[model samples]
Target: MNIKFSGVLVGMVAVFAATSASASPRPDAGHYEWRAGTQAPGPRAPLAVARRVWVPAAIAMTDADVCQSMMTAKSGAMACCASHSS
Candidate 1:
């Protein structure tokens, strides 16, 4: 009985490991290629670069604007400032 239970447990573990490994995304499955001198199709590369730069700047500007607006208002200043303090 103990041997049978151990075998079943080991089988279950093997099945789970196989399924998890197969479910993961393959490294080469995306549009971008990592080989030297092989640029991703035009515009996509630049667009990705721009996004990396612009998104953080835009978020910071938005947070500053919100904080400024909240300070100007008499009520809810504490709550707004507290939330944005982070």
Candidate 2:
């Protein structure tokens, strides 16, 4: 395509985009803003750490390949992934 044609195409897209944006409402226009912080936070419990969680050290790309590798490596998350993937 010639430069003139490409320029016209870009100009048309810009025009449409500008019109659409002007017609659309502002993102935060209808939302409520929360400002209340009068109440104090309750007591927090100490975090517990797992000693023997089987998280995989090696990373793989595909879901099936990851499952297989993790299964071989005995990762606990792979067992959980079986439920989610199904």
Candidate 3:
């Protein structure tokens, strides 16, 4: 019957989704050779928080930064970055 075939198809899809959801990947060991004389990469800083997006603090932005940031609109330079706004 069409109803029985549809029911079996839905049941198979549900079982497949449940099985796929439980297969999580293993975490990394985070091991490294600190004495190898090469510098290791440090933690990365995120670009955005809560609502505002910004350039990373480790990066040095120039005067052109304000122009680029406001490229989306004709707003004043005061609207560039809330953290640096006076």
**Which structure among the candidates has the greatest lDDT?**
2
State every prediction's TM-score relative to the real structure.
Answer: 0.32, 0.31, 0.30
Candidate 3 total steric clashes: 0
Q: How accurate is candidate 3 locally (lDDT)?
A: 0.54
Better of 1 and 3 by lDDT: 1
Error of 2 at 69 (Å): 70
lDDT of 2 by residue, 1-86 (tens): 69999999999999999999888755434444344334454556334423443333443345766666654324434553535442
* Local accuracy of candidate 3 as per-residue lDDT tens digits, 13-71: 99999888766453232333323233445567343323333332343455766646663
Superposed on all Cα atoms, the candidates' RMSDs to the truth, in angstroms, are 11.8, 16.6, 16.6
Q: Give the deviation of candidate 3 from the true structure as CA RMSD.
A: 16.6
Clash pairs detected, candidate 2: none
Output the worst ten-in-a-row residue range by lDDT, candidate 1: 50-59
Which regions of candidate 2 fall more than 4 Å away from where they truly are? 25-28, 32-86
Q: Once model 3 is optimally superposed onto the true structure by TM-score, how far is the C-alpha of residue 66 displaced, in angstroms? A: 43
Write down the lDDT of every candidate, Cα atoms only: 0.56, 0.57, 0.54
